[model samples]
Target: MSEKTSASRRAFLRTGLAGGLAAGGAALAAGAARADDPLITDLEAQPWTQYLGDGVDAAPYGLPSEHEAHVVRRNVAWLTADPVSSVNFTPLHELEGIITPNGLCFERHHGGVAQIAPSEWRLMINGLVERQLVFTLGDIMRFPRVTRAHFLECAANSGMEWRGAQLNGVQYTHGMIHNVMYTGVPLRHLLEEAGLKGSAQWLLPEGGDAAGMTRSLPLEKALDDCLIATHMNGERLRPEQGYPARLVVPGWEGNMWVKWIRRIEVGDRPWHHREETSKYTDLMADGTARRFTWEMDVKSVVTNPSPQAPITHGHGPTVLSGIAWSGRGAIREVHVTTDGGINWHQARIEGPSLDKSMHRFVYEFDWDGAPLLVQSRAVDSAGFVQPTKNALRKVRGVNSIYHNNGIQTWAISSEGEAENVEIS
Candidate 1:
């Protein structure tokens, strides 16, 4: 590479870092040389250690680098009167590799984080059950267990965008969603143990948190794939994440995943609680509301090329990557757009793209840096292509939040800085 080009690439690295690209520049620089270049090449020319610090010097539990301190879950202080009733956003700009760390997953609580003990914690299953059973945490352990990685998304995520782009980064706009591996007993095992009666069709699950969140769920889902998880990513649950126990309602809104779960009452009808009724309802532009909208529509976002992450490679084989997901099933396709919505190229999906799970996708491109716009559209196993923000606005009419699965665009300048912007 010429000195001028090398200088330019270094400048791009700094520009991209400040703009918020999740992948570290130094790591990229270390391995920048193309493979099969020359067997006699000296690796000392690289910036990072070929094999970083050993054992204890490295994290016992891995963590993002110290340079990534700005990446964190943040909540708007005034979103609620107190922190107890607030929401925190996951640092989408600072995360990579799909699985969000257990400690940094966003939190939304109506009543502060609950402190519950597994010893004293007991789940009562009653209502339409053949025999009302109150089972302690120990009783739950007796049932067979299953493991899976699923994303939990709060329904009210991106609520601030109704009046245009109120928040700056994707962290606030799309951080409400997080993917994690969980180990727990399936909901079916518990319901089977309680012996659901023939009339049992729905369940009213209640949480032990101060919020006392409760929601009615179909028996079909309860028996299908839901889990009662106590561990995330092989560690004890964090206090803010409902430590002792939490109901894992797969592919559904987070509100229904009752945290610090305490009771399950099988019922015949949906119990319209404060969360399901008054709060989560979507106010449409037609002056009507969309209620009981539980299924999170298939959605995808380009995490890089946003304010938190920007193109720092200056026009070489730049790797563009992002995450795609669907509540319906596995992501079948992820299309990338570099020219706003005018043109799009399908990204190569990599890693485990499981059903109802987060799928990481990447597209390599040479960027000229001339003003650019980027977005990612996901097509799920159901063949549902993620819609653009304008398309969503045309139908939903930018009225409210509940399911804003619209494709988001990131505007990039010649200098490589990026910011959130919406385009047709």
Candidate 2:
């Protein structure tokens, strides 16, 4: 063979051998990557897998796992002067299901949480009644108890966004709300026992807090679904949630629920209290305010892919989850939009759609590595549909700080990051 032909043959063999080695190396690397996920993919024993967990009575009152420490109620320091008489938002982004945990529920107090001993507490029912009555905690428990789930929302929830999308996560904007099962006696039976006068038009519920929170509740609502609750989520009410007893006014603002309830006075008209006229009232641009806006409208928020809970995995099958609720009635349906409201598809409503309670929803789809503008709209049994921010502003004006139940938008980038945004 010629020298040039021999050299060419040798070079060709070397090139082919290097290429084969490269391919084998890539395969070995891929196998190692798969092997690294034994904690999730493999059935091998791990630290927890090999050992036994704590026994039954380890903790008489159990707590959540240590992994969930970040899931907590947070207060915006600038929103109020002090933590005691201020507000703290629920960590809605980390929560799931319809019922909110007792400890994680939002906290709002005008004077601070009251620390009243249940043994010393007394409930007074007076004014416009055939006979005034005082009942102790034990007396309250004996009055034909009932249990039901309901959502309690502050009328000022999302109030900061009236002018613009001021907050990032749903916990900051819409976390001033919570849903839980309450155990108590109906206010109707109690009012009937007291023999309400025909002339009584309203009931003034007062709390024992230093601020002495008070509100005028219509007689119709008092006889409908109002509850003087002492237990929440199958446990005794937390002190922050008005321990001992609080009025659970279903379908009304949280402020009207009257934590640490002390007295009930039957009256003929609204007392025009500070909370009703100066605080919770919606002030419009034209100077006229919408007063007594008690019931929260239909509202929904995408929880999983929010600012705090962003998409982390590569584009593929993605499950979009959220929560929807209304004060008027049960949620009938929820529609999700991923194209800035240009198109919408019905999301799967999960759990029991109870009256005046939160409903869980989920929408699943394969992502195509494209930017998304996501939003959710809820429809209540009363046929009331959630409105857009622009549509709500048109009716109530931007000056209104309370009752801002407009639809929210979360913009997701192609890289799987999410942010709060306003879409035209």
Residue 186 shift from truth in candidate 2, angstroms: 0.7
My TM-score estimates for the predictions, one after another, are 0.86, 0.90
Q: Specify the poorest-scoring 10-residue window by lDDT in model 2.
A: 8-17
Q: Clashes in model 2: which pairs? A: none
What residue runs in model 2 are displaced by over 4 Å at the alpha carbon?
A: 1-33, 36-45
Off by over 4 Å in 1: 1-65
Residues 1-424, candidate 2: write the lDDT tens digits: 5698547534533533455455445555774554354656566646687778989999998889986777889989999898878999999988889999999999999888899999989999999999999999999988999999999999889989988887777899899999999999999988988899989999999998899999999999999999999999999899989988999999788999998999999989989999898888888888999888889999999997887776665477899999999999999999999999999999999888999999999999999989999999999999999999999999889988888889999998885667789998
TM-score of candidate 1 relative to the true fold = 0.86
Tens-place lDDT digits, model 1, residues 1-424: 5798557545634644654443334345566674442324657655354656566756766787777776678887877788878889988777778798987899988898888777888889889877789998888878888789998888877666755655657887889989999889998888888788898899999988888889888899888899999899888778888878899987888888888889999999898888877888888898898877887889988877677566665655677778888888899999998898788898999899888888899998887768888889999999788986677788888876778888887888886767678765
- The lDDT for every candidate, in the order shown, is 0.81, 0.89
